[model samples]
Target: MTDNALAYRRSHAFRTAVTDIGGHQRFTRAYRPQTNGKAERFNRTLAEEWAYAQPFTNSHERTAALPGFLHNYNHHRAHSALNGQPPITRLNNFAGH
Candidate 1:
């Protein structure tokens, strides 16, 4: 989901791209602050923990590291908001877990 930005809400190209990828854009609710705040926090954490955690020799190296980083982030890293549990712990009856 995106914030209530005019570019995301009004840009024809953006909408077309989302549709082309079999997805659609949804905006955060204006009345619920936490929805947007959570997304912003995740972005900050992703940048801090993965994107800038180390120097890569090249873009390819960084790109190659993303899957591992995401696995660790979602399945291993403890989040304060989740009561010190990893994100995966919050799932209810996950298919294979």
Candidate 2:
């Protein structure tokens, strides 16, 4: 996915990686907050629920906790947007169907 960032446009490696994977980079339109609303909300939720949820002595410690937080968010925590189901639950249901 593409954002309105100059670094992404400047990086040839990033372009190559996405193209090689047969995934096209899609950019949100300027002045369209709705287009990226879900991503913005997810970021806020990550920060509030994990990154700033506790005090950390060092950056490494905070970063180390990210994987666990991600796992819980994806597999355990329920999301109202997905009808009160976790992301993994939705994915499993879809796969079964």
Candidate 3:
């Protein structure tokens, strides 16, 4: 039951059930992170929320924390873009409609 996530990439956002409109990328000078703003933001979020959120003694501990982090990120953390609601809320609303 997958949608635009078909075994292909950038097929067409919204062409099917969904569209993953990722930002474009190009060679940029050093210190110009805005060149890949969307990916950069997600990377920073992952770093700040999961990778560096707490101290882990080993790789296993960090691996154990990933599921919890992903759950919180998808179900609890609010996104300003969604009017301060978690992303799952939008999906649920859309599906209900």
Each candidate's lDDT (Cα)?
Answer: 0.84, 0.80, 0.64
Residue-wise lDDT of candidate 1 within 1-97, one digit each (tens)? 7888899999999999979967789889998889999879878877887788899899899888888987888888888888987888878965534
lDDT by residue for model 3 (1-97), tens = 1222234244453334333323342333446556456556777888998888899999899889988887788788889988988777877455521
Runs in model 1 lying further than 4 Å from the true structure: 6-26, 95-97
lDDT by residue for model 2 (35-59), tens: 6776678778988998899998999
Per-residue error at 59 for model 3, in Å? 1.1
Each prediction's RMSD over C-alphas, in Å, is 3.2, 4.4, 9.7
What's the C-alpha lDDT at position 11 in model 3? Answer: 45
**Residue 16 miss distance in model 3 (angstroms):** 23
Model 3 lDDT vs. the true structure? 0.64
Task: Name the lDDT value of residue 88 in candidate 1.
Answer: 88
